[model samples]
Target chain A: MTTSIRLPKELKVRVSEAAGHAGISSHHFILQAIEEKTLKEELNTNFYEEAEKRYTQIIETGECVSWEEMRCYLESLQSVPNPIKPIARKLEFNVKN
Target chain B: MTTSIRLPKELKVRVSEAAGHAGISSHHFILQAIEEKTLKEELNTNFYEEAEKRYTQIIETGECVSWEEMRCYLESLQSVPNPIKPIARKLEFNVKN
Candidate 1:
């Protein structure tokens, strides 16, 4: 497909120079740049969405394992092939309600 | 410093249970979870900001190296101790204006 884009004179000079140095057409360079940018945006969106989902789940369940507990278990795995897994549980409070 | 947060009864139960399983206090677990989330968000922000800056530079300069050119150069580096760097340049058009 063909399309048109407007580049200021300065940009046109820059693109022409860059394309010459790279030994490829300006069209390919622009296409590659667009692809790189689009992919990164998609990846960023997915990362945030996944994090949000996990955040909500943690909030609703309140099921969490402390960093201290998990770290020790993880460290042990450095030496041991199959170390025991860390378990997550609830905390106690004084009040019934 | 100490702070207070309200968790629904069900979440309170879950937090207690999870903490028990992990052998840590509910407070520590919650704190760690919050820390983890905050760090990831900071990282995500930095990643996007860096990408945006690069994108703008490319647009203004129109100086880009094609993916095909770069990929081949990159692949060459896998076997050779060092490879020549790919150059970026501008493209030619029929019309002067």
Candidate 2:
């Protein structure tokens, strides 16, 4: 199938020059650009969605360890040849009601 | 400095259960989740921005090769021991004015 698009005289000049430098047809360059744009957008969208899913799970299960403890454990492991996984636990908040 | 947030009773129960399972404080779990969410979003944002930048350059320069030609060149390279970059060229459109 054939389609047509109108480019201003200035853009035409740029396209022609770019096509010449790339050693490819202006038609091919435009197509490649569109393809790449779509692919990247899709990938990024999917990545964010996956992150959200994980976040929901964490909220639902509340499974987590504090950064301070994790950091300390990691530091302690620096001296050991083989380090073991640090234990995780719930945060105790002193809620005043 | 310390900050406080209110979670519903149900959520609190979930967090405690999750914290117990993870062997870390509920506080840590929430922090880690937030950190991961933020990092992924930033990375994805940067990725899209980079893609847009490249696409803009492609448009400005009009430097591109057609998918058909690129695909053929890639296929041909499969049989070769050492492959060279295929030449690119501008597209010629039959414009009616």
CA-based DockQ, model 2:
0.01
Worst 10 residues of 1 chain A by lDDT: A1-10
- What candidate 1 gets wrong by more than 4 Å, as runs, is A1-97, B73-85, B91-97
Candidate 2 residue spans exceeding 4 A from truth: A1-97, B65-97
lDDT of 1 by residue, B1-97 (tens): 2323444465456555555555777555554443343345446666887999978877888876778789999999999888988887664435776
Candidate 2 chain A: worst-modelled 10 consecutive residues by lDDT = A1-10
Residue-level lDDT of model 2, residues A1-97, one tens digit each, is: 2323444465455544555555766555444443343345446666887999967866877765677777877897879767766654456756899
- Cα error, residue B12 of model 1, in Å, equals 2.2
Cα lDDT listed for each candidate: 0.60, 0.58
My TM-score estimates for the predictions, one after another, are 0.40, 0.36
DockQ (model 1, Cα): 0.01
Chain A vs. native, model 2, TM-score:
0.59
